[model samples]
Target: MADRSPEVAEDVDVVVVGAGILGIYQLYRAREAGFTVRLLEQGNGVGGTWYWNRYPGCRFDSESYTYGYLFSEELWRDWEWSEEFAGQPETERYLNHVTDRFDLRRHIRFGSKVVAAVWDEESAGWTLNTEDGHIVRARHFVSTTGVLSVPQFPDVPGREDFAGEAYHTGLWPKEPVDFRGKRVAVIGTGSSGVQIAPAIADEVATLTVYQRTPSWATPLNNKPISAERQAELKAEFASIKETLEASNVGFLHEAHDRKTFEDTPEEREAFYEKIWRSPGFAKMTTNYTDMMLDDEANAEFCAFLEKKIRSLVDDEETADKLIPRNHAYGGLRPPFVTGYFEMFNKPHVELVSLREEPITRVTETGVETAKGLREYDIIVWATGFDFGTGALRRMGVTGTDGLELTEKWADGPITWIGVMASGFPNLFFPGGPHGAAGNNPRYGGTQVDFVTELLVHARDHGKRRIEVPRHAEEAWMTMIENFRQYSRFEEHGQYYGGNTAGKAKAFLLNPGGKPKMMEAIGEAVSSGYQGFLS
Candidate 1:
């Protein structure tokens, strides 16, 4: 529907798949390097994950200051964010602004879902078959598919019998969903559920939140950026960018001092409170740098959070249920919020801890739990996503010797630097398994940027194709497994950060520290991609 030539007669030198943040950057870099590029997206518009997840209160955990492009000074200067952490709208708008400014829309084919991508060894290219029966070929393939793109719906019996509107936060409707004077039952207490429940409760007559597992959440000091602060940031913009790149996660400030957690309990408490008052993702665990490394330090932080949650929620029973006691601190993704716990004080809002009463079935009216049947006009499955391999696996992508990528990654998605597969030649993957995780929020974004840079370099250097050696990939996989074996994090049952979850085994995050992970990438780069042959 967008202004583009028919796919029947279109082809390009390279195909940059998925129009998420990384995909957009890949297109810009490829085009700038004078390589013919075609961008394909399944959605009608740009902003991949943001485009689909339009649920109420959807937001970014990372602050707006360093969430976006660092490659262009002019682009960063032109767009000023309203808050430290930009909401979905601001993030979406910024992407749109970038798209418009760079004219990325021209090369992107909207409403085209790539169903299959089979490698053509003779031509050293990929033949992409779209769901609409359109086929296109490209010499190079770059998958910028997001890590958490695939929605994971739990197996609830009789779900098909539900008469009411059932929606997943990952697949929210494009149009506004009105919950006025209706009973709304929201499942899952992860980031999405925590965010949307509070905002939607204000409108709905009664809101019920079903929680499977409690999460560690702290206050998100979300506020409007003052003009004075904006001006100050503008004055020191160059230094900010430089700081972002040099750091492990590409954040503006250095990661919490590795020695901070070594202090006394009183000293640790004081330090954490100071950092908790600051803006951005570092507030929760970064203050005490050893929070992730040492169990004793982790317990102290968890106790601190338990106290905070207890103080916030008025109901003692609900507060205790809300407080996480089972998992170790920093095991799962830390939930951040503006006023999440405060919403529990509202009479209309209720928390149903599913551990006590597991969901049995979904009837025509609502869900039936072991405790009782709760009727609702609408049900929101805020039940997170399939991380790491799901995004690429769902698309049915294939590699050399007619090997299906999904089959190869059946055990778990493995890669040397989380960039390329052993069998997949000339295909680069950003945000794959064994790359960035936990302590490295900005690593995935920065790595994607770096991958784009390396791609540009390879193109400019006249390399027709490249592939990682099987031995190198095997070595990297062994290193990752060993890292997980030594770390005590597995006891916490956290996925990817090194837990033995069968389904989450393929998640793309290095359990080791970000500094070490980035160092590995730097070493790979210095070797002129030694393990990879062109």
Candidate 2:
């Protein structure tokens, strides 16, 4: 066992294991609630996702006004965003500014990656050890490790054989990559691939994009937010906050509230055209309520999008390859993109469908496929992350009876409202599994509020140990199973569950809408904190 001396181990009321936007807000709230809070971050700075994912053309799909903290009116009014969809650097700047404005840096220990956290039943607290051999003992442990923090590289043969410079979009280096006159090969067609391919198409002498699955992308009508519009939004910040809280997807877009089959072909085409012209993820919302639920309705939207794709691309075959046929529209997280499809029109750009000609291996020159080996100057892996529970699983946490969190979640993650596990006492997870599904920043604040309420309750009752009972956890899982019955997530292989690695499908996010999920959480709290034991 490591040293348990008071001098070596600092004790606090709460230890937050991340310094992202969620962790920042959580630390602030815990301090306000009279708890001595210490924050540990692996990165050199705050902005967990924004700090690492500095890929070219990386930006928020949600609107700027709806994607920030609603807790402080002063902060909201003071921080002005330049664009409707803020880029990676601007988002990072905003997060750093928030940390400075609130003076949160002093509480944060940079480069302190937590390696292990063990629950001490005798002391009724958690003992955490950092990678640098530093130890911390806290009454409460909170994990705000955002879902997309851990990047997953493609498990292709001979990945290390590539002689040229290789980079993953999730873990891009801080220095600017000069793609000028370089032959670039980008793999995967997720949001990052869609964003990166177009952004570098002009810069690179030759750009080759390898696609396994085609993403259904609507045009991001991204433009500068005028000074006048910024002022108006700042003035009505309260109303904006209210709208965000009440909405389903944690944005202000109002659904059309009609069925897709109700409208005529002309009317439907006109509505889709209007949505296509607008910015943000409004296309998913400003349509029939059953667009994601009903197959026939979803097909109509898919056909409409395919037609739009066909119109954008010069060649019919390329456009056909881009159209997603397997999954329904809005089935996976809808990627709002700009110039993704139009990039194919450039003479220097080339699209290789991996589904037709699967990648065989990575050679010293470049990627080798069934057709032949293609040489490149650089390779960009836009492959996604080990999302949902991967970030937390890597922390090496153990609870009662030496129950390892990794072992507990080996099959899949199970929790009561994605906040706490059955055996993990005094530990909270904000924005983890089974939580609200929506704009991450918006739901992040809601999660903070939920955990804070529980903390406050525990303090009021003089409770040092808190956890969900086994029965409660099982019951919650059952609730999640029932809710997912209506969702089409299982029909398609996506990351919604831990399905990327051929794992048994499980509902990772709460299938119920944000409003209903929040209501259920609130109701549970009002009912004497049902499901949780103190």
Q: lDDT winner among the candidates?
A: 2
Q: For each candidate, what TM-score against the reference?
A: 0.93, 0.96
Model 1: clashing residue pairs?
433-508
Worst 10 residues of 1 by lDDT: 492-501
| lDDT (tens digit, per residue) of candidate 2 on 377-454 | 899999887778878998989999999998888777898777888889998988888886778777778878888888
lDDT of 1 by residue, 192-258 (tens): 8888998788899999999988888877788888899888877787888777666655566556666
RMSD vs true structure, all candidates: 2.6, 2.5
The worst-scoring run of ten residues by lDDT in candidate 2 lies at: 490-499
lDDT of 2: 0.84
